[model samples]
Target: MYVQIDLDGPAGTLRVSGHGLPVVELVRAPGSPPDAHTPIGSRRRALLTLRVDGVPASIGPARGRLLRRSYRVDARVGGVRYRLMPCGYEHSALSRDGRRIGTLQSSGDGRVVDEWEGAPDPLDLVLGTALAAAFGTGAAPWWETVGDIVGELIP
Candidate 1:
């Protein structure tokens, strides 16, 4: 089963729905900086919180390794450590214990594809989408920045 996330919803909100899953709403907390304005090829670090159906879900701080492009966010939902990270360009992978359980497409209307054996739990769907919406796709390949710099130097 795959959860479809609509990022084009009303400002500060995302809508998640899929097979056998109730329509879940994720709302960005007020005062959080929007991730859309981040420049390409730069690391994204947005301190944001999303409310699941009006209840605040505690999402841990996003972490990144020095000199690495991968960005990660860790959340303990019901005591299970869940991690969300970029597995590819514009794609966010959801994993537990180093195993990818799902993926969220960050472009356009996002979609969370489930790799779990059965229908995805509602909480996981919400968490994955929340993390993706918060930090996904603000950066591009490092070479893009270098290319831009070279273009400027030549001109």
Candidate 2:
């Protein structure tokens, strides 16, 4: 199965859609603050809300580690707790109860890959892609270096 996440929507919004899946929309909660500190060249963290077919489905925070490039997000979708964390370079593992059920490539194309038999649930795909988009992928620009240096000096 193939899933795609589109980040070209209006500010603070993401769209996830693919064949055989209903389009899911994720919107950043208003007034959500960026993480105070993040690993150099990594994306800043934010909290987001996921909606399926215009109904609130789940909410979570996506955050990056300080001094490391890894990131993770925790959310309860359909009453089942799920976590999305970096499993390798440019990809993230989606797990529940410590078992990885899927992987999402946050880099080029933003594809979600199922690790188990049969296609992944639509909610899992939406939650993983939403978290990935909010947390971002790959290296950030040079400005992040300045921010990191400044953050250290201030604290």
For model 1 the local lDDT of residue 22 reads 51
lDDT of each: 0.55, 0.57
Model 1: per-residue Cα lDDT over 71-139, one tens digit each: 667766545678876656666667865667887655434543434435556777766765665445334
lDDT of 2 by residue, 1-155 (tens): 46677764224557777787767776654555433232111242344566766766655544444422335666665567887776555566777656677766654233444454356677666666666665543443336656977999995
Against the true structure, what is every candidate's RMSD? 5.0, 6.6
Structure candidate 1, residue pairs in collision: none
TM accuracy, model 2: 0.61
Candidate 2's clash total is: 0
Indicate the worst ten consecutive residues by lDDT in candidate 1: 37-46
Model 1: how far is 77 from its true place, Å? Answer: 1.9
